[model samples]
Target: KCAQPRRWKAFDGKITEMDTQNSLRGKELLEIYRSINTRGIPKDERTSVLLTLKWTVKEHECKLTQEIVALIDREIDLMSREVKECNLEGLRKRICTLFLQYIKIPEFNPQVAGLIKVPQDPLKLYKNVYFCHSCEKYLAPTEFPIPANSHTIGRCRSCYQLDNEARQREAYFKYRLILENLRKSEVDYQDDSKIVFLVQLPDMQYLIENIWNCQSALSACSDLYDLVMVRWDKQHEWSPWNTILLTKEEADAHLKLCNLQKTYEAPFIYRIEQKHIRAKNYFAQIPVMSSFLHRSSNQSNAN
Candidate 1:
């Protein structure tokens, strides 16, 4: 009988040789690996890859690292829906490597285990140490104030606060409260993927003070606590351009507003649109806001 060909080949002197690593199929797989984190791919393919990854992780039932499993599960759930972004490349590669480590090689299985050892004491390595970019020091995870749904590791909360006070001289306590309330009210909104985290306290202040002129659009109320930001179009995500600042009572009325064309005058509609355009122009400077804008534009185009 003829000898079976090896699935992988040794690295040859030539980069273009038909060795395992140099083969066209191997290059294609590498290209896929590189693109696993890229954003321009179609959503269906992205969804499929994540789903297959989750299934593979489940099938093996690997116990060495629940971290990868947990991350995979989270990404799968997050990417299953049509959202603005999917940036989980680091987690994806970590998952792939761990999965590869478990594959039984003919004679190198023990060598793989040696390289990727199952820890003798797992708890020893899982310390919550995080490096604060602002302070240039490693601190505990408690030093940072990460959002509930965010994978971003940011500067330490102390450093963030210090910078905000010293440089920005901005008050975020009120904005923080507003964000907390908004996130808490997500159940009522039915969609919880708004760009709330990207909107800094300073940005909120700008939108309120400069854009909306520190008063409710309807009642002209100036009390910051009494004023609340709500969606202009209830079906769309609440963004700077898509929001209206109204007093507690006015916000209640606005939320219950069903027919805008009938409820408000033509002049009022024109004024609100003017405010939206102003907000769009103002927030367009922020890079993160572009994704929300893109998402909004795509939705509008689809409709």
Candidate 2:
């Protein structure tokens, strides 16, 4: 006798692929198999398979599941009657989204718990969490713009962005890029430069807009792309007071100068010194910088 073609004997008697595909529970398993196997299944067939799998997942019997299942059934009915794929696009997307959310729940799908990122220690999870007033959400401290001098945690970066859009509409991306470049350059210098890292986005914006007037000090070039902030005097490490805004070409020449006093006229040197004084006065307001200023004064007195 020929072997029964891949047949399984159930307690009732026998089970075949056709028998499994016809029953409701067996149809769900078949749909899952088709969803997982993408070799020859068409896009629409795969979508329908996924929709079937979404409602059939074990241990997920809730009102939300019922609503989604109803929606999927209605879409299937409409597709059968008219087959308008365009009209069902929105419904398909909603079903897929709901299914994704359904799978992400650890209770609904215990297998996914290891795949998702969650703090192993529950106590540590809340340690660095901060409250964002604007969004009224508790977020990580990294989400907030906490400057060196910030005494209290204010609104998060997202809230600040929303506030900017509503009011100032000012873009700080260019300034942020400039500040990052400055920090990287300072790190590469290998000198014990302390100020650039301490400076935040707002400080960089203030130095550029208020002190330098958003132009190259030497050539008065208004373009920010060609401009770079570098040490005014090569012997000293870069600080707010010791830096100059110059075009890339001008910066190379400026750094190469044997003597700034002789290379540039007295009037130009005087103007640069005035800008340095302004930077010193502005940054001195910070408590950390105040100590630095005090140490420098003591060293100057000692010398």
Candidate 3:
């Protein structure tokens, strides 16, 4: 009775590989295997780590039989004593592959259910396919380039690219750079950043092409690399409603700009307001960004 109590206490505490459990499930045994077998570990140190892991499994009560544990122990003991340059990486990986199946089972790990891409009912996958208007056929969801804020799904990515190539072909490389800079700036500001993730590539393209017209609002410069997107009002966090395109020179000047109404003429201010309204309407479709709009509106009301 005293021996059983000591054995249970040994397992109850941190069980090192050298510790022995009465039994172990396949998963626990695999964990023991992973916990040990440290490659590149010094030979003198390796024995201690291996011993701790073996003992840990031996003390735990699980599905593995005593014979299996004895066999594994014998192997480990031989390897430790022989000091042979035997590679165990492949064997360890094989064991991991076999044991991972237990962890991946839905019943065992319900938390991972959402991360599994495969549909529970594979035969019903066809139901998820959408009809692309441009392609004029049903295509899988992967083919579509739907933005997070898009109200309706449209053409697949391939169809959209082909259409752009034939018609309004414009390089979005500069737009991509501007978007990246915007994200970095937001991160530095350390405000809520989820709204940035909500904006997608297609949405950026639309804003550049239609809203800002892909040129400096003041100078109307078209040099892609020279142009940047900046906050309309310097005080506010950048958003679709609160952005303007400017040349690098203009952007620097605008940052130093103290008073918009004083520096810019009424007409200039009005046009900028119009652009803001358009952007506000466009970005409002994104569900997440709408929260920002409401918050901005309340802030404006407070002021």
Compared with the true structure, what per-residue lDDT tens digits does model 3 show for residues 12-101? 686434222322333454455465544666665655655554465455444543433454455466566673556555544543443344
Best by lDDT: 2
Q: Tell me the lDDT of candidate 2.
A: 0.73
List the global CA lDDT of all models.
Answer: 0.66, 0.73, 0.67
| Superior candidate under TM-score, 1 versus 3 | 3
Candidate 2 to truth, TM: 0.44
**TM-score of model 1 relative to the true fold?**
0.42
RMSD of 3: 17.3
Question: What is the total number of backbone clashes in candidate 3?
Answer: 19
Model 1, 191-221: lDDT tens digits are: 8755765777778878887888978888888
Each candidate's number of clashing pairs is 1, 0, 19
Q: Write the per-residue lDDT of candidate 2 for residues 1-303, one digit (tens) a residue.
A: 011123567888867543321233333443454354444555577556756565575347887677667766777687667666667777767766665566555555444455665644569678978898889998977899999998999999998988888644344776777788778878888988887888888998899999999899988998877778988887767888889999889988888898988889999989988998998899999877887667656765987
Selected candidate, larger lDDT, 1 vs 2: 2
Indicate the residue-level lDDT of 166 in model 1. Answer: 70
